[model samples]
Target: MAADSRAARPLQKMFSEVPATYDLINRLFTLRLDQAWRKIAAKECMRENPRLVLDLCTGTGDLALSMAGQARPGMHIAAVDFSLPMLLEGRLKFVAPGQRVGFVLGDVGKLPFREGSFDAIGIAFAFRNLVYKNRERDKYLSEILRVLSPGGKLVIVETSRPRSPLVRLLFHWYMRTAVSFLAGLISGRGAAYKYLAHSAINFYSSGDLSDLLESAGFRRVQYRTFLFGVCALHLAYREGPGNMENS
Candidate 1:
């Protein structure tokens, strides 16, 4: 609650405590733009023509679902998160049977997968919860790169602070007051909503995070800002394990 160095457990506990309403609150807070954002994110990842994908921190499986929907209709996706209840809720969201999505119980920092196993890795609106200053952030990036195949891609979608003063004023007001109020009304967890707002503010900007990705052994790193600079999508490629060493 105080923005400490070790806030992951607190936030994880909060998400687990409110797993039933997490999806509802997410939609309310983002004013339904979250779905569209996921669609765009999925499209961006699919550009690499990845057949196998992993959605890290795939809360409620929205991004994974979008990836499955937007991809070449036969893409295999592993949607993973530590919260089982959230995955359960996501499973029920799909009305039809035989979806191509598989939900796995795992942590993003240490994935239970083999090296070079996936063609693409994605995380949407979930990175800030891990806290950028944490060592786990490095672990997340390392695992991401390790699990991605040669020339694989990693796309991270996160919230950003508005650069325009007028937009910042409106964005802050919406985040602290409107978003929190709606989230509280739907999920009965205004405190969690407040924590989310704080996290967004403290989260790194697109440029800063791109540097982190580069430092983590990713190449061709770049970022795309969206939603009036209130959101960003970071794209980077894994040059295959050991390939960089020889070349």
Candidate 2:
């Protein structure tokens, strides 16, 4: 998918405006649970002790940095984002750690790597943007599969629907009113938070995300929900061609 595409225009414009306060706004909006959630996702990404990891759509590289912090010796971490400003912010954040993770400015639809390049891949809070109402969703999934090694993990932390109706209603109300208001006020990026709020309110349930991943040929999908199920962490594996056929 091109950055200039219609579906991505608002996203591009929104992200371009929020890099300065993106991390901080996220902390406030999620009441700092976002960091803890990322830590859990990072742990799952390293569950197999992958030698190389890719953080896709690594906005400001928070999860990438978390992975870098706990990385074993010789564990290489890399991140990719299409937004130059966001990638620059990620680089600045990496300075304190002496540049442990490689940051690349590129599109997810056309990852700049060879087939089977990464031992594991992780995305935080951005999975919905990749699949929600996206016409080129299959293309992006194909690119992700192209770069992931067989049996490589794809760990994702994303907003999800609550199984409880009451919890879901309250979550949606808070998102629409408080989160959008404060996040937009602090970040001065109302459109971005509007998109964020809308997406979070409408994103897939855990089961739905798992089914989507499996339909794309990933295997053994599992998920854990948190905070009355408003957020979810998923783990899925890339099945090799032979294994995919057998399965």
Candidate 3:
């Protein structure tokens, strides 16, 4: 827990500092594809017809907004992030009158919700930051599984490593050099962008992340790669109570 807190401090501070320019930097860095990715993930979450949805690590509420855009009437959407500034920014810009999306300040690793509380959960581009250590990652997955109802779904959108060696090499070079430099220049937070670039390069591959989700008690884990395998959308379901008990 101490180690986890240590890791989280840096991330929290970085996010808090960047909320003003976070969305702009994201648009620039991803060439506006980040919005499309979040939309795709939101569509997957809604396919389950979830009554209650939680968007964890919902930085600036992009995924939450997407989910609410297509949500059924009376559906509840709660978007949580540790950074209050980011949540506030999202609430001001993305939230519409009478919209279902509710922005909250909270941590994903230790969600402030009851077991079996949510029917669907979505996380975008922020899973890598939760992986402070192996144990920390396990804790996050456990909490996510605990909160999800039986057979509920969790959708994850994140950067991925390519299988091809040549593509992997080029991807790493772009992330480490061009992305880091450009984001830092635009955001005026060079260290923060550098950390993000480093995290992307070191994050798990699609297959390995799917395995991790399965080990955390999720079943029917599958993923779709995009952008020459530089990004992926992972979908996994929590099995019924009997399967979860033995997990």
Candidate 4:
């Protein structure tokens, strides 16, 4: 994937400024439903007893921590993010002694791992950030596919637009107004939160994302919506050999 240094700098700075209150603000914004969402994602990712898991764009390592909680004795989780402050904060707050979750400083578009390294991968709420310019979305997906072992699973948790027209309108309004306002009040970063709100509203639908996964050589794509379709959890698998690229 082509690197966009311009976009990366601002994102790094913005995320760096909020690690202290990131978890608290997220809990407040999602009404604590974020925890349940992570739990479900963890459950889905761990179904195959993956030995090595990668959590991409793992801000504050919430999803990684959730997975580590129920993982097998030898399971190892590598949680990666571009922001050093976020990783440090996550390490300080969530990682306990002997925990297998390792927070790494890295970028999603350019993962630093060998091909077919991870058994499973998970990302929550941070997928939209990779698609800001629309040019890197496919590249990021390809990178994920490249690093995933054959038959490895990918679980994605992201905000989605509701199907009902009324609910969609209200959700958009809340994201653009209430969420931004409250996030600003809590983090003192109104503009950052506004950007986040806009990104979520403009992100592709669950069906579109599923198609993207298929195009990247993933199969058995399935998704479930939550909170009246305001969010979705997508599960997909990288087909074994004789499938597309590996074929």
lDDT of 2 by residue, 122-187 (tens): 999999999998887999999998898887888899999999999999999999897788788888
TM-score of 1: 0.87
Off by over 4 Å in 4: 1-8, 241-247
For residue 136, model 1's alpha carbon misses the true position, in angstroms, by 1.9
1-247, model 3: which lDDT tens digit per residue? 0112324566788998888889988887789999999999999888857789999998788888889898988679998888877888888766467676767777777888899888888999998888634457778889999999988888999999899889999999999777799878878999998998888888899999988888878998989999999999999888885322232
lDDT by residue (tens digit), candidate 1, 28-131: 77778888888888987777567788888887888988887777866788888777667777777666555678778777677788899888888899878764
Residue-level error in angstroms, candidate 1, position 228: 1.2
Best by TM-score: 2
Task: Estimate TM-scores for all models.
Answer: 0.87, 0.92, 0.91, 0.91
**Whole-structure CA lDDT of model 3:** 0.84
Model 4 lowest lDDT segment of ten: 238-247
Expressed as tens digits, the lDDT of each residue in 131-164 for candidate 4 is: 6565777788888989988888889999986888
Model 4 residue 128 CA deviation (Å) reads 1.1
Candidate 2 wrong stretches, greater than 4 Å: 1-8, 97-99, 241-247
TM-score of 3: 0.91
**In terms of lDDT, which candidate is strongest?**
2
